[model samples]
Target: MNIVRKLALSASMVALCCTAASAANLTVGFSQIGSESGWRAAETSVTKQEAEKRGVTLKFADAQQKQENQIKALRGFIAQGVDAILVAPVVATGWEEVLKEAKEAKIPVVLLDRGVDAPQDLYLTSVASDQVKEGRVAGEWLAKTVGSKDCRVVELQGTVGSTPAINRKKGFEEAIASSKNISIVRSQTGDFTRSKGKEVMEGFLKAENGGKNICAMYAHNDDMAVGAIQAIKDAGLKPGTDILVVSIDAVPDIFAAMMKGEANATVELTPNMAGPAFDALDAYLKSGKQPAKFIITESKLYTPADDPKGEYERRKGLGY
Candidate 1:
C-alpha cells in the first residue's frame, strides 16, 4: 500500500483501540448501610478512596439503616446496568429477592462488612472480619478480667437483625459460658448508633437497681461503648473503674476512649474491605472466573497496652 494509505489505516486502528480502552472503565455501584457509627463512616471513606485510586466510577447509595431502602437502591443499580455492586447490608435477611434480581441481570454483587443468609452461589464474594471471632475475643478478655468473680455484665448489641449483633452475641455467650461467674444481666439492641447505645445503656442501668449491680458493659461497637461511657458517667459512676467496658470495631474514637480510660478493650475490624472486594470483582470481570464464597479478613484485639499512644494518634488522624 502507499505510505499515505498505510498511515491512514494505522490511524483508524489506533482510534478504534482507544475507544475500546475507554469503554473498559469499570462502573461500580455501592450501597452503604448508613453512617450510624464511626466504623461505618470509616468504611465509607476508605471505600471511596479505594475507588478513586482504581479509576472506578462509584455510584453510591445511602440506605439509611433500612432494608427497604437498600433493596430499592440495589434494584436501581441493576436498572442502571452497573458493572458490579457492593453492599454493606443493614441486616442479613431480606436480601434474597434483590440479590436474585442482580444475579438475573448478570451483575456481580459483593458484600462488605456484613453477610446475607442465602444460597452460597448468590454473591460474588464477601470481604469482612470474622465477627464471631471478634465477639469471642471480647468475651475471653472479659472472662479473664473478671476471673472467679461474679460479675453482672450488660450487652449493648448492634442492630437487632444485623449479622454482627447476632454472631457477636452468640460468640460472647459461648466464651463466657465456661465461666459461670460471668453472666449477662441485660441485653438489648443498640442499633449500632451512639445515641441508641446510650439510650439502651440507660435502661440497663435502671434495670440493674440504678446501675449499682452492673459490673461491666459489652458493646457491639466502639461508638456504642463510647456512648455507654457517657451514660455511666451520667449515672454517677466512674466508667473503666466502677464498670469496665469492652466492644468491637476499634475505630479511632475507640482508641481515644481507651487512652482516656473510658473504654477497656476493643477488637479491630479494619475498614479496608473495599480493596479485596474490588480485587475479586476485577478477577471475575476479567476472565469470568467465579470468586470465593467468603473472603475472611484478619482482626486484632486492642487494649491500653498495645501502642496506646500510637493507636490514639492513628485514630486522631482518621478525623474522628
Candidate 2:
C-alpha cells in the first residue's frame, strides 16, 4: 500500500471500530466511490436502507472517488474481520492486488453497480445493469425517431476507458451500424459529470456550426444529458427539437427536463443495485448457496409519453 492508503486505513480503523459490531449478526462493510452524481447518491441511500431492512450490521466507507481510498477501506474491513465486503470500484484495473487480500482474509467481496478487472473468484458477485443494452436502447430510440432523415450526433461519454463508457459506446455504435442516415459527427469524454458535460457540449456546439450540424446528443448518463440540455439552450437552440437529447440513468432531473419538453428520452439505470446485492449476500450467508456471478438489473427507456411528470414525482424523494 502507498502512503495515502496507509494514512486512510489508519484513520478509518478508528471509525470502523466504533461503528462496526462484534456480535453474531451479519456484518458487512461497503466501500463506496462517493456521491459524485445523483444516481450514485441514490445507490448509497438504497444500500443503507436495504441493509437496515434486512437487519444486517453495515459498516460504510466513502472512498471519495479515489482508488487509494478504496484500497484503504478494504484493508480496514479485512482487519476488522467483517463477515463480507462490498466495493464499487473506482476503476476497472489496479484492483487485483487488493482483491487478493480480501480473498485471503476469507471475505466474500461483492461488487455493486460497477465492475473490476480482477479474477472473478476475488468477489462473490456483481450487481449492475446491462450497460451495453442501455446504450443500445438509447441508440435505437434515436434511430427510430430519425427514420430516414439525415442526422448528425455528438456523444458525451463517461470516464474514458471505463467499462460503461466502452460498453455503452460499443452498444450504441452497434445499434446505429446499419443506419447510414445517422452518423456521430463528434464525440468526447465528459467524465460523467454535469459540469464537464456542459463544458464539452459547449465546445461541440462551437465546433459544429453552433449546434446546427449536431442533430442529436447522446450522453452516457442523465447528469451529462441534463447539463448538455442547458448548453443547447444557451446556444439558442431547442434541446429536444433541435438536438433530440437522450441518455441513460433515469434520474428525476432528466424526467423533469422531459416534462418541460427539453429532453427527448432516457434509459433507466436503477439505483437499487444494493437491493439485489444484499439479497444475494443474505442468501449466501444463511444457506451457503452462492448466487449467480452476475445479477443484472433491468433497464427501460422512458420518454415524455410515459408520464414524465409522474415519473419525476415518484423519483424526486429517492435521494436523486
- Using lDDT as the measure, the top candidate is 2
Q: Look at candidate 1 and tell me the lDDT of residue 58.
A: 72
Candidate 1: regions farther than 4 A off:
1-26, 33-38, 55-57, 63-83, 89-106, 116-118, 158-163, 188-214, 234-237, 286-289, 312-320
lDDT of 1: 0.85
lDDT digits (tens) for residues 68-125 of candidate 2: 8889888888987988888899898999988899889988999988888888988899
Q: Summarize candidate 1's per-residue lDDT along 1-320 as a digit string, tens digits.
A: 23235334534544554464555678788899988766678788888888767876677777788888788778777886889999999888988998999999999999998888888678888898988888999999999998899999999999889767999998899899999999998899988888999999999998898899999999998888989999999999988989999999887777777778888899888888998998899889999878788998877888888976797776665534
Q: Candidate 2 clashing pairs? A: none
Any runs in candidate 2 off by more than 4 Å, and if so which? Answer: 1-25, 66-69, 79-81, 91-105, 159-163, 199-213
Candidate 2 minimal-lDDT segment of 10 residues: 1-10
Task: Please provide TM-scores, in order, for all candidate models, with all chains considered together.
Answer: 0.72, 0.80
